[model samples]
Target: MFVKITNAGGYQYVRLVENYRENGKVKQRVLFNFGRLDLLKNDPAFRNIVKKLSDIVERTTTDNTEAVTIESEEDVSDAVLKNWGYIVFRKLWEELEIDKFLKERATRGRKIKFDADKVSFLMTIQRLIEPMSKLRTYHEKNRYFGFEEDIDLNQLYRCLDFLDSIKEDLETYLYQRNRDLFKMVVDIVFYDVTTIYFESCRADGLRNFGFSKDNKINEVQVVLGLLVDKEGRPIGYELFSGNTIDSKTMVKILRKLKEKFSIDNIVIVADKGLNSRLNLKIIREAGYDYIVASRLKNASKEVLEEVFEQEGYKRLDEKSYLNAEEIYGDEFKYKVLERTNVIKDEEGKEFKIEENLIITYSSKRARKDKEDRERLVSKAKELLENKGSITALEKKGARRYLKKKSKTEEYELDEEAIKKDEKFDGYYAIQTSKKDMDVEEVLGAYHDLWKIEQSFRVMKSCLEIRPIYHFTESRIKGHFVICFLAFLLQRTLEYILRKKGKEISSERIMEAIDSMNFIEIEIKGKKYLIKQRTEGGAIDILNVMKIKGPKNFMTYEEGLGFIGINK
Candidate 1:
């Protein structure tokens, strides 16, 4: 690398340029720019330093190329080392090949201020390691080792816009890459919807007030639908308006998968929230199977009676029975019944489809449900005693247990309602079109939906995906894309750890990664970086992730190499 001077804006600027080869052709990359050559020329000390540099280069090019070492006799201090956990994440990023993919796709014209791909990479890494606002990321960018990009706040926002524009293509590329890397089996996929609320009270077309999964009902939100493979790896996602219900998103997401991914013959596993006659018919007509939780209380009277009178219940485990043989544990007993249902098509045509309804009674769930109802009943009684009228909001909670007399204008406990609710306690059912698979397989597949739910939790709690600050629709979408990519990296790390028999939680992994830091010290004109190694889970994380921990001490340049920093 050598300094090159260029005249621009009636001033001369000195730029550090390096010659490199790309596509079998020579190229030059401007590494750094020192502004205003006149300032350097006016300083005698700077001119002397330039003369020394020129002499060194001339001697190195001549036959008298001898090794020159500088011995520092003066005492030196003031050296510092920063966190290096990002390096490990960088390795994983490269292993996933996302860096290369983004580099190839993140193209721009010649007038750009910074490399969009590099900015995007740093932004994603920041989101994963230390989530912050774009401004904060820009201000603290230099704190991260090897993240020396010269990007301003405006450039960062522009990069996000670029990311939003290429979101679809990027997701597709990632899906295919993951499939090849993990050998993903697309036969059975799990899907679920979650709501992420915004902090702003002002509602727009995309951020209208709706039901919040985080219980932020007063705030606006957006619904996010995530699809994952059988192994719980994310495949793709869709964002909907906050007012969009869970059931309404299934068709759109399914259609996207079918059209974009061309995935067919897969069984979609979801909770009862997405269960509807229309969704079921759509899944069937599209030649796909579904294993969805059924709202047993909402079933027809015949189905309820059959569920109550079904006698051929089987024990799922040997220790499932609490009282030896007579009293079975609610969680241990399961009964499955095969039934053919007639449903109407969009054209009013009737069709018969066979499905398996597996019902399991969980004593734990029953106890919790009973306790919850009793608490609500007590709250209702308290309200009645206080002569309080049930408002519309109260009707959604404890008020549901009370009945008001029209004549007396008084409230009383509804015995019939309690009894009806108690009858369904401890009973949960799952419906599946997979007739060939056993009840255990169907139940197991349905249970894996928890992974997708956990992924949502990670995005919201760990990554802070909610309470979005962006107002524009495109920026909002772009923000979610970053969150999704961070979630993908998190899931990929978990997958790698699990494959190595390490079974670590996402929180624990993040804790370990965040704690791996280094401290630098300088003495006698020599720099030293000491790894502040702690005796904790971080060590195990480094080992399991195959990341190199810092040695006793290293020079400043050596420290950079340790963290995979090219400079």
Candidate 2:
């Protein structure tokens, strides 16, 4: 409880009271305001007496304060949270041997901005890569964040410009080691393609209007293909024209990576958008094993016939029924059906929307299918009802009345039903290509593509990867690179928190960091200390990661730990 005290001079005083009950008896205490107590200097002794009395009165308040101690989930101070991404980036940068990797490239001098070594370079990269906020506000009260108001804003812009120049160098740095970095225990590599809409419609070199996935035909967009390792850290990314087909992209990116990085012996995983015959051809020709969402309809007639002829594939709820058991090399088996539906619009031209039933040998796929079936049943029933209504309206005597028509009379019908055959509920034909793998494992691998889709959601929602304002090629690249980095850092923090079974969002982590009040407190004339007040949960997370106090902030020595740094 808070109480306000006012003097004749209009000065206000605030006091806090704490109350508790012990053994069915109530206790009350009061705490005088520090600044307010000092202001009552006219009667020094009397003021001192009042303060002592207030302290005794305040004993009850301390009881509740001591009862619950908040925990610090992570040392997510503004500087730490903001720079945490840079730390992980530096780690991956060194692991991938980006510096030595860059030196070998003949075009290194062409992009002088990226080729050079500057502390600002890494810092700038870290800044852009930070999660999305219109303007960065980190540790404003902490002077150590080193934001000097006296410094010209031009200098900050220069830093941004310098960082923007090395866009390609940064890409090459990460791309060159794509495979070697994941040579060990790399179980899953998620691949995804998404479009970023731009403000301008004019097509330059790389920017063009294609299929706007966002349904914006007037807006020019670019297609971005990204690859991430099992740990959810980004490995590489490629930018292509918006019209670029997903199926055609994998081979080009893979070929570029194979030639540039000298990589082999890796599994390529993608969703249905990338499951093309030509793409599969390239995957096979390149000597790379791939797990793709097999298009049953696209399978060869011989393969489909083989699948249909195999009586073992039809077994259900047994080892063969949409469940996993060892069959192929550490794999499982399941069955699925390709489904298609015909549609006629206002013009009566027929088209079809093909779908698939992805049976799985694994529980993951089964659960997904179960949920999908539930949702589909709900939607399909609704659609059928809506279509039934339209059919009923067309039948004679179905309507209650008819509106006036200049030269026509209307007829109505009762109990009219749709004319379409319900037997067509299930349609289309196709089969899986994974003859060697179990059906469950194949479905599981294919559905895992959802992880990449989730990543795109984070990129757009958390990082604001779209709605780019910059028009120059360098600025455009810089903007995306930064958004990516921010995502990387945000994901890293979430990963660490999850390991401890604690849940906190990247935005909340930032909010906790912001809640901190860093005061330049002077206890006495001669003693000064910088105090950081954060909850206990936040600190616990930070301690587990060995990031505590002011000392853990990155130092030159830590940066030197990265490969090929010229300290």
Candidate 3:
């Protein structure tokens, strides 16, 4: 075959001409026409073809000197390429001893056909790298270099069932391991709750409609109560019915986690959502201290009168001062209001609970408060203008600002309510039982609550924990267990990096894992592996794991060894 340039319809075209002898005479015919030459030159695929041709020719000269390899560029296209980035996570998984735990459980149960440990590993790794449904994860087994298709979709489901069976054991095992190995901090832990909603509206014993943190009012969901140590390392988690209130789950989680793990002198920290008179009483009665945010908007008339006093407030720094552009004092200030309240247990016995409500104000927080209020106001006015037949019954968000006129059903923006809300802007109050602790310590503990919140984001977004499709309660709980393990592994890697001075993110770690691809090519009869060079946080991870960097070229045995397939 030969390439020939010809003109057709006033356009220059490239053609593949093949020559052959039929009877006694030789004849030539065009085999294929590659459209216009100019367009073909600009096409990416064509450019790739040219580059591949150039590369193979150079390689044939270079590689043929050592072995019979790479017959053509088509051979290169026929080679298998897959993500081997999981090698990093695999090491971490084994180090956590999850494999040993699952295998031991498998031995205790009836003789199962499939490997629960392997399937669980598959699902957890999928949750870390790219979360998907169980059936989808089964189908994507070949997407990894060392992964095999020994287990089917049914096996993955069975693994979840087994995981549900040993959920508590697994949690306890991890808690003990972390405490012993990492010196996991339990002196003070942060606990928070978030709702994971399902796609279907069908309710079950465990899944029902509740006050969704996700604002998924129409969807059925299950509340997840997560407990993390001071450093944000997960201690354990619990799943409650969708109707379970966030505040109600607090005492239950704290009490159980403490008893199960033998946590000592644990002080719990949480947001205002879990801050209630009853919760505080139960916590105190259980011999645990709590630092929770107090709702400044819910203050009584006398409390507000005392909170707004300027006599005891202190400025942290002069950085908040404004020159010529602001009115009142914009410096960040804080004041502690001490109060004693009697909290009673189930026995009707009352005890005095002393608390220091740390009230803080800042110009930056003031700006954000104003912006958020204006946004709500904008949405409120639009709601009023379009308030056709919708009954405004003082609902959440902007609707709370809409008051009904007198006894009539008609609604309008309540200026008084707006003014009252604005008065609390830039002001934040934290109620803590630790009266002896300094102000900065109290604020610092409250601020670390974001780490637990960030963990929820990791579960919801990165791990895709919601929109659950499982109908059975065990499956739902098991799915959460898998997601929790994935999140733990990711956080463990991040913690390792933080200690090593890298300070990488989970998203970046995922990207780095994704970029570690390897090409498996067959040369003559033997196979060879070629790794694509990577320059990302994956390098840091591989180094931290004490593994050699992937070479440009490796034998099949070396590739399998590198992926840790043999042992």
Candidate 4:
């Protein structure tokens, strides 16, 4: 509602009007006529009317935002007694259209006993802020302001299965949405694998024990292959068995990108761990390109000589990096060596492949490498003092630098092995199928691989996606899907803030959000929200999103409005 001036018969009158929708049409109605505009223009008349309305609003105003009536006084006893942080996140949630997508799925599917959309959102927001077990989330649902839906533990468990049923479709939808929303370019994707371990030692087909990156050898684990776009926004992800090797995890994710997402003509960037011959052949056969770290230590002697040769090495100039002088000094340099390499396919047939190998050197890397070897050699010397305790069963890495005398068991430091290892220090190499790409572009694409690694850290620490408590495979998949979507929202928020010239990490975002506080109180049989002190950057976050600040005392409806809900 707003004030308007109406002109009729060559005169003007003051009017209060409202715009409403009726029968799919917008119409305006004059709510009140406040006498002639000439009279109201007199200072006293205008002041009196304004004061009267202001007085009436506190006592009698009732609108969708002013009040949301509860069923009875008993419901007031169960109002949100503590805090909520969904105001900013819900805005992001709606921007990504997750609520709309889930609503469509819920309404279109067979009817169920629970609110599927609300339940799905509850899981996602919980993972985003404070991760916990599904049962725990169900038990604590009333803590958040908007989760008044009647739900139980079984419904939460079932939602995971619901999510699993639409995993591929959901990924496809998110990819398209992210592209449209952020103008994200998915042409170059980074693929890397990590192991997510379970707390239990028991093994299932999918959760069998394998090499644990966490060093939990006795526990079961699952291998996760994550594919992210250039800026670290997730495109899609795949789950593999616990024992699946890194090289073997590539094919399935590649198939997902091609078949599920319909992404064609893209380059997959990865580290040396996934650079197996068979994986490369499969990628080439499927018509995709790659940029993977090279296994320089295992290279043939001739190739190693060419890599270390001084003739072809070109020093990296200041133009190599955007913040070149600040990031890399004059000691950083690189050289690209081209060669015909052999690749083996699934059928064991070898084919000649032309590739450009990028080799880089840094004085800083050499110094660090020297210190690391000296540290290991120092450990080897410490072991020489106690040869009896060095057992074959103990597989510590530092033990490899020790050499035993041929006739006796006395151990001595292997100078030859240490010297041989020193030759490759300060040098790094990257192999790429796109030979036409400039050295800087190749280096830039390969350097951005850390974004994916940072993403993994965000999920494992901030999202807590691992330690699968669900026994069923579908629920496990669903759990990951929930966390993955939450990550997508978090990253999207970060990206938007970055565009606005505000930089924040996932850790700081969660910190500020968790510090937001509020409580519910009853006054004259009407429930209202009493906002507590909000800490950190809560106001800054809202300002960036263009949301109005919450009043110190607001109706429950107003609180709901902050989360994009209306009666």
* Clashes per model (N, Cα, C within 3 A): 2, 42, 0, 0
* Better structure of 1 and 4 per TM-score: 4
Q: Per-residue CA lDDT of candidate 4, range 1-567, in tens?
A: 567788888889766555767799997765345557775575343544444333333443465455433333233332234446765777777777877887777667556667776788889888988999999998888877766778888999999988898888888988888888878878899999899998788888899888888788898999999998887889999899999989989878888988988888999999999999888877877788899999998998888888778888876555664344343444777888888889766678888778898888877778778899889889888888887767782435678788778898777888888998899888889999889898888888998999999999999989998777888899999999899989988888888778887788888888777766555655346666656555566766767878776666666887878655411
- The sequence of per-residue lDDT tens digits that candidate 1 reaches over residues 119-231 is 87777877887788888988888767556667788888877777788898888888888888888779888889988887798988889888887888689888899998776
Better of 2 and 3 by TM-score: 3
How close to the true structure is residue 274 of candidate 2, measured as C-alpha lDDT? 81
Model 4 weakest lDDT span, ten residues long: 70-79
RMSD (CA, Å), each prediction: 12.8, 12.5, 5.8, 14.0
* Clashes in predicted model 3: 0
lDDT scores for all predictions?
0.75, 0.49, 0.78, 0.78
Error of 3 at 112 (Å): 2.5
TM-score comparison, 2 vs 4, better candidate = 4
Off by over 4 Å in 1: 1-81, 108-113, 317-331, 345-347, 393-395, 406-408, 522-527, 565-567
User: Could you estimate the TM-score for every candidate?
Assistant: 0.81, 0.56, 0.86, 0.83
Candidate 4 stretches with Cα past 4 Å from truth are 1-84, 107-111, 325-330, 393-396, 523-526, 565-567
Model 3 scores worst on lDDT over the 10 consecutive residues at 319-328
